[model samples]
Target: MNNQHKPLQNGLHVVVVGAGIGGLACAIACRRANPPLPVTVVERAPEILTIGAGIHIPPNACRVVSSLGLLDKLKQAGGYQVKGFTLRRYQNGNVLVEKPMGMRMKTEYGAEWLAIHRGDYQGVLLEAAREAGADILTNAEVIGIAEGIGESFGKHMVVLKDGKSLVADVVVGADGLWSGVRELVLGRSFPPVETGDLAYRGTFTREHLKSFKNERIDQLMEAENVQVWLGPGRHAVFYPLRNKTEYNLVLLVGDDLPEGVRTSQGSLEEMAANFEGWDPILNTIISCLKSALKWKLLHFKELDQWTKGVIALLGDASHPTLPYQGQGAAMAVEDGAILALLLSRLQNQGISDVPDQRNQQLSDLLLLYQDLRKRRTEVNVAGAVDTRHYYHLSDGDEQICRDKELASLPDSAWQGPCSFNWGDAEYQKSLLGFDGLADAERTFDEWSRKKSRQANI
Candidate 1:
């Protein structure tokens, strides 16, 4: 669909304040809309850099990736399919629970789950967005936003830090956790609440595994399984990336970083100390790591609203989901997929040329987006919190019960209730099987009709 579609509709210009995965996805989605809207992404950095370790393109997010015609591209870029998941005891490498996801995720949830490096994931989206004709401007920092000023009601002013301004019909706040756009929308500074956890994250090449000459590590990599090592007050996640040629590891522990320091070079000795007497395989993997970076995890309380006038928030700006569930990036991608659907359909809403009516319609669309999105994101946040609690369980009856529940999960993916919502069919159906674009198209029409009836009343 790149460069082959008709020229953009040119009715409304969209300015996206961030060029991260969520923002770039938004740009691609808007460009793909029928009679597509024009999008210009304003990025603060001098250049877009590939950062982070691995990200999961779960079943729900796979819907969006497939829609953008990038599924094959993702696979080509080292997004390997995850075959299964294992929860192991940290004291010794004993598997407590195991579940299958490879073919089963596609069979049950309509799409396969992908574990890809963050760089590869963002690279594909960024390329497609540019090919789809999204104007991307880096080193452009947004400083302020003004709307309904200077004899113009159709345009909003996005004031950049360098005394330049861009005009747009809508401004998207896809800026990340430390989002300046978020503060702008709320008219006050809001900070992310610390989760009191810091992730010691590392990624290693396939050669590193081979250098170990350890059969256990080699077999694990070949299996392409997602493994979690559970211990008291801590947990570590390990998954294959880059077509199973690379490995990503994240160890979550109580934060000990200096105040106000969000990230630092992690000490390997300290990292080893945190996992004393743990699984030798885990320890061996740790020793293989060349370096580790410590990142403090933080989140935001749910907001009452996601939009202020023509400005709307998406991704981390509004949600700031914790990484416990691996849903943070997926939710952001969903936000872009759904929000673009509504905005692209804006031209078809059949509003008169009256500026007030048009503005109100835009506001209504954003509000409806907020209503549809709020509950779902809140549910995800709770799910992550639940998993975190269970994953970091101290040795006790509850922990034993949790392990038992995980071990006894049914043969079918969507089956009877389990203590683990992540694996429970009923719970996961609502999470993994959701189709955001379809929901937006269906809900927006119904919303518009209800609004029309109310206005007549």
Candidate 2:
């Protein structure tokens, strides 16, 4: 694992579209995880703006970040480490479920759940990628993709808005929900389908919290913890951030696309309207909010194939999960890290020993990466969908059942395997070894070898 001396394809070039969280993380992970490879990131947007209100970085994702050597940088970026998650009744402040989060996760899983401003988090990854020898080009829209035209591997002729063309050995479509690269590969006009839920996301200052008299509300805004209020068909999370100076508010409501939510316009008035039935404290908090944006939560129906030829999708481009599980960005980060690892290894294996035979190795490696990703992301997607209904439990019996299930969990279950031991090198090794990928490839390889033997016979 001495990255500097590790062999890599001498001049392998990789072009990544979209410099969002996943793209940037992919670049950094590829550079730092394995041997260094030439990586270029093309972002269609001129400047990276903080569009997301807030995102939860679970312990597993945090482990990957720590493994990538981003803990200190994240801390410096004003990311808040969460202590625990408290589930409470929607109207009254009665604790329903309390799960230890930060230090507990670290002790059990060897990582902490970190919550950070999206902009700062993206900046941290982008800066790291740039410093790690990645050529980051902003305002470069990829309008066309030319696959395997001249080279055996393939070339992505990225036509920028300025009519400039760039080529690379591989093109990664981390472009996100409305990915142009996905369209080029999938061969369909697929769009992000709306989930009939609207998200009112905002960041509130301490001054704005004066209207909330609930002690639990005060605790949520001031303490280093995550609090979620669950109701019928709706839920809201209030958590402290920016060193407790500000509170991040996320109100998930089942409503049509409100006019105020779409353009990122409108005052706190529109935000309050969505919470009519919610507690007065919530309405008061929304009324005092200085800024807010409404996001139409769109969940993509699963695609049969995430890749074809040289172009492949990443993050939301591959699998878009609803926000219920709070693992959207986390899953994206994991995807980036694992893909980088596989490609880097393939690049190394090809350069020193098999230069002339590199294409097959690279192709096989990409397929392996896809195989490694598919089912795990599918599981998360299913869990996210399922949790949406679970959290928004409308039926009284259903809510009672869920409560019973939660309560029935033995204390030993809670204490069992809270987090992963990321410090162990063996644990890292396991992540690289796609369990199902290996099994499937093994089974297929055995069949192929058997068929060849029979032919010889």
Best by lDDT: 1
After superposing candidate 1 on the true structure, give the runs of residues whose Cα lies further than 4 Å from its correct spot.
1-9, 148-153, 411-414
Model 2 Cα lDDT, one tens digit per residue, 1-457: 1111111245567788999888988888777845687888989888767555567777767877877789889988778788877776776646776766667666665567788888778888988998898888888888887543433333346666777767666678999988988898789888877777777777867766755566745755666877777788888887866777777888887756653344445456766766676666666666756665667787687878877665678899989988776678887888787777667655554443343344445555566667767877887787677667777887488787666555543464463331222112243323222333234345445644664597599
Residue 441 displacement in candidate 2 (angstroms): 14
lDDT of each: 0.85, 0.70
Candidate 2 wrong stretches, greater than 4 Å: 1-9, 148-154, 210-216, 258-270, 351-360, 407-457
Task: Spell out the clash pairs found in candidate 1.
Answer: none
Model 2 quality (TM-score): 0.84
Residue 203's lDDT in candidate 2: 83
Model 2, total clashes: 3
Q: How does residue 405 of candidate 2 score in lDDT?
A: 55
Residue-pair clashes, model 1: 0
- In model 1, the Cα lDDT at residue 5 comes to 15
